[model samples]
Target: MDSNDFAKFLSRISSTPLRVLDTSIPNSKYIYLDLSYDNSNLEKIDASSSESLSRFVNSHIKLHHALVAFGGYNEIRSIYQRSNHFNINQETERNVHLGIDLWCGTNTPIYAPIDARVHSFKNNKNHGDYGPTIILKHVIKDVLFYTLYGHLSMDSILNLKVGQFFKKGDCIARLGDSDVNGDYPPHLHFQIIKDIESYTGDYPGVCSKNDLDFYLKNCPDPNLILKLA
Candidate 1:
């Protein structure tokens, strides 16, 4: 987790796996597909206007099936504190993404990707926030680290124990519905952390442009494992 080593490590793992699929799929079939789609009824996203990014998935036929499959994570820029923060019962403004979003569709099975123990779990109910979530601890090559899986169904944590172990690629949870999942769409926000820093089920998945340097250090690109960077 040496912030300096992030570039070296992530670059190496980015192209390693090369693909994602259903971890539970024994055949590893249907691993690759064009992910663009539009007007999908999976959630509340209505692609009434073709200009919307939401329609990018539907309007463009070339990217028909490239939804987030089970392989690894896709990178996206995010910000912390850039969005207005307020006290509970108060309102806040816009936010930016900080973690790599695995675009596998809703109810897609999410696996551990590594053998790790459940560090903590929580159901963050904020709009646009991670719905049911679980954070697991891992140590690769003696470097202690953890991964946070957000936007999961509540059942994912049903028998999950704080110290229980999940083998890599073991199905641990399913993508959840909009009611439980944050408002936008269903996807998993997977993050890698060198340290949890006393944070529970929640971590600043979004950071401001100013604080990005600090967050980029704490939360390196998860493609270090997915190798899809």
Candidate 2:
């Protein structure tokens, strides 16, 4: 199905709002992050380290949590530079992030938005990788889709099993510390996929400019359900 059709399908299924984070506190804010090449702020500090990133977020923004819009074509030079994982060759680099990232404290609760079955789970133990990742499959009105929760804590996937069921608003996992969560600050890399396409446990959350069309079509804007930023 096309993106418009997929979005409609998602809206139908998501009648109730999904609480990916704790909603108890007041004054909780969502700050939009700009990692695009033209943003001059990126040049001031290093984004690769958790400490530097945290300071950057806390210093500039008063919000408790930071929110990033999905499908943002970013120029995350520090993180993607000199890495074979992101830059395959001189011509192309996977700098455009495809997922909506929610930056918050470690051990924060993460919930399943709808009833879903665990499709796969794994610990991607690589630098700049999704430390503990889980993919859940959901079906609504004869349409199937998947949700990916990356950068999770090790404890979150300790007893997880394939085909495990989770009800809507279920606390399936918690945010991970920087050491285990791809060496980045604590955050949840949430994404929606119409088709997994042979990928299990992990998928490319970023793509090069040349392949932007394919990835954009494959991964719809996660904000259709998030509705935050």
Candidate 3:
């Protein structure tokens, strides 16, 4: 099915509420982060440094977490420049982010949105990569899909095994620190995939401008299930 049809299917099947964060906390705010190329705020801070990212989040009072819009074409030049995995070449870079990032603190609990089983898990130990990641396989109304939880702590995968199941709202994992989470600030990179193809614990959460159409088709807007942004 196409993106629109897939979205409609997801909406229809998502009868249960999914909480990736502690929304029960009063006075906590979710700030929308504009990392797109046109966002001038990107000029004020060092996008590559985790320390800089931490300070940016703390600047706002009671800001428990920050939210990034999915399918955003971000101007994350510094972070991607360090790794060939993202840079690809001097001409074409993977600057467009496909996942929705929920910027929060380390050890913040992440819950499963629906009944799912561990499809794959691995520590992607590389600069600008998803440090410790987990992919959960799920099926709803006979439509099989997968959800990726990136930038997770080492402990999150310690006891996990392929086919291990988790119910909705179960604490599946926790956010990792910058050092272990691909050297970036603590956050959960969540993505929804209609088909994983042959990828294992790793998948392209960002894509080059030339490959945007293909990636967009394979990975739809995560908000269809998240319903947060």
In candidate 3, position 80 carries an lDDT of 64
What TM-score number comes out for model 2?
0.89
List candidate 1 stretches off by more than 4 Å: 6-15, 18-65, 69-94
Per-candidate Cα lDDT values, in order, are 0.60, 0.77, 0.78
TM-scores of all predicted structures: 0.71, 0.89, 0.89
Which candidate, 1 or 3, has the higher TM-score?
Answer: 3
Model 2: worst 10 consecutive residues (lDDT sum): 66-75
How should the candidates be ordered by lDDT, best one leading? Answer: 3, 2, 1
Candidate 2 lDDT over residue span 139-229, tens digit each: 8877889999999999999999999999987899999988899888778889898889999899888887888788777788777786653
Residue-wise lDDT of candidate 3 within 1-229, one digit each (tens)? 7778987887776654355666463322555565566766657988778898577655632443434212232334345665777876867788778888877778989999889999999999988899999999998878899999999999999999999999878899999998899988788998888899999998888888888888888888776766664
Which portions of model 3 miss their true places by more than 4 Å? 15-17, 23-28, 60-79
Runs in model 2 deviating more than 4 A are 25-28, 63-78
Q: RMSD (Cα, Å) of candidate 2? A: 2.7
TM-score of model number 1:
0.71
